[model samples]
Target: VARLQERARLFLELATQRGLDTGLSRGSAVIPVIIGDSALSLRLADRLFEQGINVHAISYPAVEEHKARLRFFITTLHSPDQIRFTVDALATTLSELRQEALYITPTN
Candidate 1:
């Protein structure tokens, strides 16, 4: 689980830094973003399927196939030590990805 949380944080931070449109909304107009194919919104539906909170991957036409992902969550329910461990794991994973920019930077 620790591994999962870090990946989530890293993904979240990258998304914010890129200013990619959540694409989860109707009025959005930013770099397209997606999760489960209904736009990016994941509130009530998420809570209802708490046990199924797998990933937030984007779909095809709008995105590509393998690009799809499931989402994991972090909350008060998890301990700080656990969160930190997961963060470290995510950093390691991101470093290994090699082909993608973690975030959009000028000249990137």
Candidate 2:
């Protein structure tokens, strides 16, 4: 649960920085950033469907279940530039969604 708590903290900080605006869409309202085989599970799908959360569910042929994810959460101490970079990285990495191949694959 420690990991989940830390991740939640990171996401809240990020969303706040993004100008949470009205406190809606800040915390658990849009989280858990589903990962692994858990993403394919019925429970998770139901939770997402029922909650209507804006989950960014990543799927296979892209990443295995263990890696397939809507990756969110970053350290609070990371600089704005660092956070921007991370966001940019995600945008580029997932650009296929936009029909723009910003990156063929993520680098190590």
Candidate 3:
């Protein structure tokens, strides 16, 4: 479980560094990238799927509305390279979505 925690920590740090939210993930194997918009969450999941990452999209009912997110589960089997690739892919995909105007950045 220590290995899993470490992987999760790495993923959280990398994702947070890229401006993605590692929501409610306190050393847990599950890391959630909160996207806020349900449609954007689903689109991000689909985009990641196209890049061979199988993350799940959590939307309203599963979570509160406007708190939709993409959920990633980290395992000890994942290597650091894989984690880096996933984070890069996620960031790229999100940037692409933003460029396409499918994602609207939320104002604080």
Candidate 4:
């Protein structure tokens, strides 16, 4: 449990430094990176999945609306390198998605 907690702390710090909203962590194994938009959250999750990182995108009904997030679980089995890689991938993927959103025109 201690190792898990330590990894979680590291993850939170790295994620926060990268501007990812990780305000839902309590120094536990579970860390929630709040994206605030349901579509963005799901896109991030799917993008991460394509990159081989599997995490759950939590949205309304399970959590409050507009507080959609990707929940990350840090375990003892995960090394520091793995955590860093995951964070890097998440940041990159999210940035890409935000950039894409900027140019998306409404069809209506």
Which candidate's TM-score is highest?
4
- Model 2, position 102, has a per-residue lDDT of 38
- Per-residue CA lDDT of model 4 for 8-107, tens digit only, reads 8889889988999987577688889998888889888998999889899999878886788999988999999999999999998999999999999999
Candidate 1 displacement at residue 92 in angstroms: 0.9
Candidate 2 residue runs with Cα over 4 Å from true position: 1-25, 28-68, 97-108
Please give the CA lDDT of all the candidate structures: 0.39, 0.44, 0.89, 0.90
TM-score of each: 0.31, 0.31, 0.89, 0.94
The digit string of per-residue lDDT tens for model 1 on 35-106 reads: 333322233234324433233334455445533332335454545555444434433333333223345366
Between candidates 3 and 4, name the one with more favorable lDDT.
4
Counting only residues 3 or more apart in sequence or on different chains, how many pairs clash (N, Cα, C under 3 Å) in candidate 1? 10
Each model's Cα RMSD: 12.6, 12.8, 4.4, 1.0
Off by over 4 Å in 1: 1-70, 99-108
Evaluation by TM-score, superior candidate among 2 and 3: 3
Give the lDDT of residue 7 in candidate 1: 46
lDDT of 2 at 59: 62
Off by over 4 Å in 3: 102-108
Which tens-of-lDDT digit does each residue in 1-108 have in candidate 2? 454455555555654454322133344423433335433433344444444322355567565666545534344454455545544443333333334323347679
